[model samples]
Target: MPAPYQPAGVSVGDVPGVAQTAPRPPLREDLNGLRGVAIALVVVFHVWMGRVSGGVDVFLVLTGFFFTASLIRTAQSGGSLNPFTRIGRVLRRLGPPLVLVLVGVAVATALLLPRTRWVDIANQVVSGVFFYANWELAWTSQDYLAADPSVSPLQHLWSVAVQFQFYLVAIVVVFGLAGVLRRSRGVHRASPPPHVYLVLFAGASLVSFVYAADGTSRLQSWNYYDTGARLWEILLGGAVAALFAARHPRPTHERRSSEFRTGRTALAVLGLAAVVACGFLLDGVNEFPGPWALFPVLATIALIAAGPDTSVGHLLRSRFGLWLGSIAFPLYLWHWPLLIFTLAYSGKPSADLATGAAIIAASVVLAMATVRLVEKPLQAPGGSIPRIAITATAAVLAAALVCGSAGWNFYIQRSVSDLQASDELDPFTYPGARELTDGATAPDADVVPALFSAPEDLPVTSVEGCIADFETRDAISCEYGDLSASRTIALAGSSHAEHWVTALDMLGRDRGFRVVTFLKMGCPLTLGTMPMLGESEYPDCLDWTQTVMSEVEQLGPDYVFTTSTRPREGGQGDYTPDFYVNVWNELTSYGIPILAMRDTPWLVKDGVVYRAIDCLADGGSAMSCGMPRGAALDPINPTLASSFRLPTVRPLDLTSALCDGPICPAVVGNVLVYRDEHHLTATYVRTLTSELGREIAASTGWW
Candidate 1:
């Protein structure tokens, strides 16, 4: 059987569009046209979508084209492929401007950002400079996205990281193959065809792309930003280059041939249409660089094949196109930081027409100057001076990143401690903490019960395990409550459950109840759901919850308590309130009472977490450091409250547990309420035991 698709093959001594009879080679206007369109598409898309610019796809294709073209030329002339020389050339060309922008961004960040945000900015600077920003992003996504006013200035470098890594891998693969081919010249020409390299790379890229498409809904938090998961985009471009170089094109002189003007025009129109489609159709929340990405990639490939003699090619090769192409690199460099910074500082994200215009204009001017003065000089033959200057500058930038982080840490220690001293609320006298921990406050009693100390052994019934679920524990091995205990209570949810451990353990011991915790990070207990950060169907969440419920139902728990809301954007939108209702309905079906605790306030206003000390140090008044109770619980979930009409469910408002009359105090009763956002600290939870103990014993009539 014939293969699925035959890739373009490498044929020696075939230059597609150069007139065979001509003496001096003219510029490939067609290639320049391709560059112009690609860059323009990228700029337009980024300015609008705040999404990945398909322009990156264009750049990838161009990289493959140029790199392959150079290698083929060198190979035909019987010259050795030198990886070091190539890398040196790339560095000399791309490094100076990159270093300057990085340094400038660091300087700007240091001057503008608050102390609370310094560590993140410093780490991002290091990651961006080292070409590992993608990994940094992936790591952060585990906790949160850069959806804050304090987002790093260097976030745009994720693309650069992807490109740099791709270059390294491509160099090794291509050079290794070239060396082998030369050695085996005596054996056979067609033994392992040169085109196979491109074919294999393309096949792998397509597979990964499909994986990315399918994986987005499931692993958007982790794999969305991971370099390993994103490698396919870069590989796709490289594969295109290899395939194109491998092909021996038809003679261009004959007008009636398939490669003539009419054919080229048809392809160019299709390509342009694809570009327009991407610009209009692609948006945030769509699965990207997956199947939907074919519009941009196929369009780019089409334009590349439409030779310079065509009308569209000629237009693309014109002065305007070339000028935009010239500044494309710097344009891309400056646009994101400019937009992100503007949004960060403005305090309001509503984009105005004038501001957007100003940003675009400023970006253009900056790109023009950088390309003309900075990029051009470094890319020139005797660019050694600029390279040295850039190296010195980058070293300064690296030092600044380190010093800024350390200095911010020092500032937090000095200033926050001074402010902390002013907080004179007595720990022993505060009724909330005192009453909650009254019975369990003794340091002598083992606060944490033996059963709830570690993860519980939840039973699993399915053959499909949690391989696709990276952080989810198998139910078979992770159970929580002991059925033998007369008073059985289960803690189940996300880290919210983990945060309540100290209080729960204390309550369990004092009340003589078994506190079983069924928890996973980001994976809250629901009637139905999958693990938050992986591909496995969260049949486990439902399964685990169902099993726990069965156990709880059989044993007849006094109360099944869990936090039901988190402080998010505008202090609203908790995980599916409907699901919470279903869970309540399920518990009531088994005659079990439910006590749903309202979520604690996050310290930072905009959903980003900040160290309490850092917040106090950064000129933020005590009020701004944490959400006020009214602000934190503005839009309450009435749906959850409605379930309490069943008489078996109750809403245990912990709003007062960590809050004053109106303000949700960051610290309560002289103790820090949280180690991070939304989760009570183990230390603080100990303090809450007294108040919680009194309330639970009184409310449930267990006294």
Candidate 2:
């Protein structure tokens, strides 16, 4: 559907003639049709193709163009430029449908989603109501625990938030100019001159453009939803509006000259081509809201400048296009959640073409129902400030009630779990290492402790703030095991390596060796650049790695422990990349014995990472939540092959303890094996202390 700020029933043909220097241009049917096309691209790309359609960029431009133009016209015509009236009109138009969707999603989540996901859904619902969902996603993007494939139903609201923010900014700019004109000693006008507005728009656009370019390069995932980074596109629309306002007044009875029509037609054709081509050619996720975004922004401007007189405009203004535009906003809202909920229930990474078509059909029906029943009635001509305010307040309160209930339930569950946990359980009943090595059957799944079922049930390292996050550049070292031990074993690498620290710490404390951790989130001790979220190079990780290695060399630890291999695509077994070999060689040069542990099996099915806890919460059995042993690991550890040629680099594989003969269970010895997809839970890792100690002693003779 059209942008949240797009005025209902107000087309180019309906705008009243302004008594300014230039006659105001009528709203074009073609622009509305363009909005229809943009939303179509977005839905199709998000649902069937799993790509961004660049349609949101087009919508941003249109929102800026339409809203700014209307405001400028109002100011020039000596009409009231009251922010409250304009903002209220926008709120009345957008709020009802958005609230409807939010409430619908809340009900769907309760019925379809597992209880474990309720907290997140509730948080997103609250954010969506307040128009800060983008910032919420931005903060969550940095959290490693929160990173999952289960897309939030409210994720698409980020664009709506950006548009809402822009509306506020537009109101301020327009009214601020009007107030300035009134205060001036000599200049007495309803609005500032067109040039003044143009200068301001240009300056703001330039600043925002630079920030977007730089921010996208550095922290794209966070910047992607940032309103500040998105202002340039809106300002470009404002600039277009200013230029339209500055046009020379045309005679009321005169038609456009032939030359003007010819130029407009040429522009319309090129503009249409550019808009269509952008969806196909550009990679929206990787290169957008930056300098590369200029292509779509410019094309949209050309189309706006072209007006609705040409053949291309005629096509855009067709009945089909107008209908699509009419339902565009609600369609955009309904489609994503429908797609995501369908995927979750179907237990598929993505929907097939037929399934996708059914989803789109369902979305269209819902959108039409919402537009007819909710959006149209509230946005009718009699909408007043008090009415709109009361409705908005009711919507917010309803959303708050849903979110509050979810949060309260989450707190209650966590409290009950905490109280139930006890240190008095029998060691044999909870036998971790003994059951695995002794071939004893594990306790019943129902009898197993509910550890690792929630985010609060994290490993000691995470709970104690030992493991660093993405933004952390400085090395955070923590000591574990026997403090007075003469021999020191250094653990270094990413979170994969950090997961093994619990076992190592227990082993060291028992056998009298000091354990020092040098861990960075997502950063392994490899020479090559690591790929961060969105496939961008992590400069902080690379720089941090260099510093870490330098410190490790100076410390001259007797043994350095880290993960050595990663899983290959298509379940082809783990392999050590060249970077691992380079790091091994560097460590060996310092005469530091390298204990290269094999990485854990990531729980993945059909290329999507699945959390064991989520599967369990959804009533899946241990075997059902687990992958085949062969699918996750090679028969022989890949690190073993690399270690064969290097005397100091010894490979350690505990797959035998973590997995059975053919199958890898989610839980071993009544303990949940993984905290999320790959990281081993501290409870499970502690159970491996005995086995781990035996292996390290055999390899290093430290004990």
Candidate 3:
């Protein structure tokens, strides 16, 4: 969360123990120390507590404050707002450290990470280097704050991305504001200059905050990384900075009284305490970049407003404080990747206390080295750093980083497209689920979705408009498998239901039945408050479910296909919940028969969930990479245990087709079982065509 987009004049002396002749303006050292403290919270909480520490929010505030204040001061001093100069200054300062991190991460990714993760990491590196990582993550809905997500080393760069984007907008705003101010200077002699800019920023902040507050509850994962949602935090910081710079030092002639100093100290103490306490008190992942973010924003403002005379400043200006601030940015860059790589190496989700300590220590050392080798060289006087030349050099580095990954991704896109187009697997080579269900054997062959091609391997429902996204209630439908066939099977539910559509589609085509998909991303027609796919606000999900069910009922399909039972949370058993039964009973009341299958196993080990391809690329054997069958499913089918099983609500569990007698391997019969944590790959699902076909005929007699 710590970003290096600081005020341009941060000299070598600002780093701890470095000597300088020129003294700093007020609060610079204090803000720097705050940066250090924020990064400390981020690293410690990320490595050990596995929770957001509100430190990223703090960085957002500081970054806005520093950049805006610096820009204004430049304007006040009659410096030109030349776009090239502004860009050059930012690039010259930021480019080296960023490139260094990218290059290092690229090398580490190739050497240390599984090949299944390489393309993703490459995407991350390119996005991080180009300063759009936040948007990339937002669009993908990568749960940034999940306890054990597919951890990326560059994930923290989202803050940097947001900040960099803010800088670009701020530059354009400043240019426009300067022209307006120059024209109105004499006309507005009665009023202060900052009021216009304040109104502008305040308006923008209010609009952004409104959108963020509404968005956070509906689609929190996207809202978390959305620049529009997050811009208010940075804008408010800029607003505060503008007010301070225009107002200038509050009459330096005034003496500091003892009571005033005590109040300032109390205020500073309270602010610091509030900032540190925020993460422990609030769920930052779900509640942040919204109204709750004000806690940290106000807390940071309080820290800045406390003034240099307070003991807080005395403390921040101390040796250790400066040292911490010096390495904050690099420490943030190093820590997450180290923590993730450590987890991958150990095959554990969280780090032990000893591992946490070592990661922190190594990060600090690397941060220090970066400061000396990269940052210090850029700042050193004799480096003769030509701003434009370095900007061009940095631009070249960024372009190279982008193109390298882009080329690889281009090849992947072309290759994956061809593979998808020619997707029929030879039954003898890729038996997949058939091996589990029918003891099908195949000639020895590699996995159908090669490690590089596996991540993109997904079901037919992946196409846009096939299913409603988490934020929308539109009953988006897509038809597959003999669209003209008279007998229709309505596929309704969440992605768990969607994954099975591939097999159903294959069955529908071969057997002259139509498959109509009415799906939502994570909503599985639950009417009660229970966690599904780690999401929230079931009201919206409930609404979407009702809409989809109504659409299916109106269509009056011969049978409705959905997932009947889910693997119970925090246990080694799958079960039909009262919520799912609510949906089933409702459908049955309308005289529609339900053909529901048991959910697939979510492969987890040592607290780390395994995506099938990643497991294989991590050097895990097919048998070894899988969870035991007993770990995810009950001895007796849990649907049979459900008290609400109406006779019309037929349960068609195919656990045998998804798992072997004792185990569900990540790979089966030379094909990857899952594309991600639990979604069956289209490649794998295709292999289940015969198995699903036979089951459907027995359940609905449609075949």
Best by TM-score: 3
Tens-digit per-residue lDDT, 106-158, candidate 2 = 88898888776777778778777777878888877732111124778888888
Rank by TM-score (best first): 3, 2, 1
Cα lDDT of candidate 1 equals 0.58
lDDT of each: 0.58, 0.77, 0.77
RMSD, each candidate, Å? 8.6, 4.2, 4.3
Candidate 1 per-residue lDDT, tens place, 1-703, comes to 5311100110011232222222323445555545656666665555554444466666665655555554444443445457786666555455556766777776777666654456666667777766788788777763223324455667667767777776677667766676677777753221234486677678878787877776564556555566655667667766766675577655556755655678889888787677666656764224454566666777777887765666777777688876666676777778667766776677544236677677778888988888666655543334488646655565676666656656765654565344333323234443334432343232222212111111111112111231113334443223233434577776766666556656666667666677765555566667754433332344445655665566667656667877665554554434336577677888888777777766666655554445554454455543566666665565455435555466766655555566655776554444445544455655566667666776677568776
Q: Which residue segments of model 2 deviate by more than 4 Å? A: 1-24, 74-84, 142-149, 180-190, 247-259, 381-397, 400-426, 440-442, 445-452, 529-534
lDDT of 3 by residue, 8-116 (tens): 2222112212232223344478878888898899998898998889998888888878777766655454455565667656666666777777877787777777877
Residue 258 displacement (Å), model 3: 2.9
